[model samples]
Target: MRGALNNLLHGVRLICAVIALLAFGMSVAAAQVRFDKQPLTIETGAGARHQLTVELAVDPQQREQGLMYRKQMPTDHGMLFDFDEARPVSMWMRNTLIPLDMLFLDDKGVVTHLHEGAVPLSEAIISSGGPVRYVLELNGGAIKTLGIKPGDRVVSRQIGSAG
Candidate 1:
């Protein structure tokens, strides 16, 4: 009888532990997208360049609510939110902390609009005046440091394809 009671108690404890772990896992899974990093090269001008590794946000939800509530971004690190088709995009820095430079790019990766020195934590609409397929949010001043400007070419290899 004693051994049976011990076994029963152990089983209950095991079940409780499993439930706790599963709950924790689900919470973590809800917080972030499963992004695949892609290699990219940004050319600002002749002989001026930067190599980057950007997170590919290929889903609509990921692209719509990009970098919004984030507090910090590493240097040379940024998020590239992608849309299935080019459309006019408007973004706001609702809960974003670190100032950013929003680069709006067309399908061909030509920078069409640049909202530079974006003020963080503001609700004002920052829009890409024309249609855009990609929005790159980088640490403030990173574009200027790389000499990136409007009409400069931005190139990216697909997430899992060889280029």
Candidate 2:
């Protein structure tokens, strides 16, 4: 009976070990960026609108922490800040490590202003130029490289109803 109990204990230990390893593996698999993805488009008006995959920042906390600690981002990825109201907004690169092009847009999705190649970690104010409801941040110099400019329009579900 003593020998049988020893064998059963060993078997139970082995099973626990296996279960622990499986849990660790599952956690590793789940360690991915948690950004919510959405389809976005920018109508250049000059022709050839551009489509992108963007993460939306709807709340004040997300908007405040916007791209602060990120070291790198995919070229096609961006973050869209929606204020839900048409009002002047200002931005800065304070804790943001990666340079970005900030696109300020009105509720109608029209780009009201563009701040291209904004310096990383700079505290200087980047203004919206006018009342806006959305702000899109993309890799630095993307505005010039992608031919995006003021007068363009952004299309996304998070921008609220379009006119």
Best by TM-score: 2
Question: What's the CA RMSD for each of the models?
Answer: 8.4, 9.9
49 Cα displacement, candidate 2 (Å)? 1.7
Estimate, for each residue in 1-163, the C-alpha lDDT of model 2 and write its tens digit.
Answer: 9999999999999999999998777445434334577999988978867889998777776777778777899998899998888899999998688999999998888998999989999999999998998999999988988888788989988775534
lDDT per residue for candidate 1 within 1-163, as digits (tens), equals 9999999999999999999998677556546656677777777756677888887777876665567656677787888877767899888887577899988988888888888888998889998999988888889998778888888777887522311
State TM-scores per candidate: 0.74, 0.76
lDDT, candidate 2, residue 27?
48
Question: Which pairs clash in model 2?
Answer: none
Q: Over all chains combined, what TM-score does candidate 2 have?
A: 0.76
Best by lDDT: 2
Worst 10-residue stretch by lDDT in candidate 2? 26-35
